[model samples]
Target: MIQEIKPAIWQILGKQPGRNVVIIGGTHGNERTGVEVVSKLKSMIESGRLNIIRGTLVLIHGNPRAIEINERGSEPHADLNRSYLVDLLEREPTGIYEDQRAREIAPLLIVSDVVVDLHATNKPSEPFIACADSSGHEQVYQWFPSKKVLSDPNYVLAGKLVTTDEFVDAHGGTGLCYETGQAGDVTRVDEVMRNVINLLIDQNLVEGEVRIPSNECEIYEMIEPIVLTAVGFTFAEGFGNGSWEPFVADQTIGYHGDVPLVATYDGVVVFPKIQELRKEGSPLAYLAKKVNERKKPPRD
Candidate 1:
């Protein structure tokens, strides 16, 4: 049976022609910054506080049921971000809450020209953008405020886990997701909204002056996703998500069944989580290396 159904799609037209951009927030229930900022953007448009100078702007509340409950997904382990694959949409509508929702959005993703799905981390960490270099366009990273961008080749190699951006790209649209600060951070809402506004101005979807930053941005290429199956697994204390400490090859970070898992190269950690029992294939964390040519060549 279909659960919570919230009609949160909003489309506004501009006076002239431009790119069809879709911004999605709250793909994960616990990430309220998207919902809060999207709603605020909608109000600004309705109140004549902002104008779409060109093309069309579409706003979507990605996972309303999950957001309503203030949980990561509608149910345990059912992440909406990882449920946008084409196979799941076509053959697994009844699979789970996330699958069902994916079916509802698969078509919409194709029609939009540019898509930005907003999300926030579970714990307090720095903000960043996660995109695939294969997703198309170098400027996609510039549209956000985060100075750090992650291009995970393994995520593409894993194949099964297709994010909203990848799914959108398969359908011929450019898509990317922005990871804001912690989900519960009070400043998250404003920061996200400001970034969205900047994107609008930068993309020329709205009319305004935007100060594109001259500050340097860094690119991190995800080398591997650390799979956690051991009931008892953890990293060294103080080593956590959003960490960018370099380690010599073979330095121990954690262990599995008495087997020490060491760094394969000089790398940094991302998305460190401590779970008593992690489902198989669950990425406990990711190891990445800073890259200079993030705009050129697919990650190896």
Candidate 2:
């Protein structure tokens, strides 16, 4: 039976006392790839095919109700991801569905040494990893090499949960968000899940073959976000995933009749969800760079 929480489901695997690796999937209900990946991993571990080397593996379905309905958020359409870092029970006295789940999972998240929040984008693109903390980015890269790593401080702040970030900061552990691909990409889903399992093994948290590459590609970071506004006459035709070309500063990206929506910053266009019917404040793309000391200063 699916272990049920208020608006989520969770399964604990290999409950040994060693390293802790927590895998969260379906944070955005519509992103089915993560849900499938987490389910598969849970099944593998339960069947005795996958074993934990030293520590434990925690698999969580972040938004079960949303996943069931195949929508972005829970029944009331509240994003469960944004619900973290706050006292949900007190804030929403009526008890929002996602808020309840957040309260229940917060403790588990706080105790975890490593966290991998799996998600799928609305647009079709190559798999990429998003990390807020520089140290966390490095640790994740060492485990599972990504095609690109967006590591802008502002982007990190914009995409991070304050409570979750605090937990990682306190533990000096890594927390990463993996965007496998657009929802329903089974091939990429399997690939990312396998890589994540291997990472758990390599970190000595699980009992399995450690797959490491002799030479790994460098990870790229985002310097700035390509912000889209509601006032702009940006008519996105078709699904704009990674199809948009590199944009130089002051170049015209789209037109509001005769007015041009010029590029405010110089960076490659990434994750442009043209078909997305979400709000205008949503991120269009970002310019990234490598996570290094030069980019991130030492914290006191």
- After the best TM-score superposition of candidate 1, give how far the Cα of residue 210 lies from its true spot, in angstroms: 1.7
Which residue segments of model 1 deviate by more than 4 Å? 1-6, 87-89, 134-136, 156-161, 241-245, 274-277, 293-300
Q: Model 1: how far is 112 from its true place, Å?
A: 1.7
- Top model by TM-score, which number? 1
| Per-residue accuracy of model 1 over 35-61 as CA lDDT, tens digit each | 788889888888888888888888788
Model 1's alpha-carbon lDDT is 0.73
Which regions of candidate 2 fall more than 4 Å away from where they truly are?
A: 1-16, 75-77, 86-94, 133-136, 155-172, 214-232, 235-239, 243-245, 256-258, 274-276, 280-300
Q: Write candidate 2's Cα lDDT for 61-138 as tens digits.
A: 877778888877776437776666534434644478777767777666767778888876666766667665454455
Report the poorest 10 consecutive residues by lDDT, candidate 2.
Answer: 291-300
For each candidate in turn, give its C-alpha RMSD to the true structure in angstroms: 4.1, 4.3
Q: Count the backbone clashes (under 3 Å) in each candidate.
A: 1, 9
lDDT of candidates 1 onward, in order? 0.73, 0.63
Over all chains combined, what TM-score does candidate 2 have? 0.78
The TM-scores, one per candidate, come to 0.87, 0.78
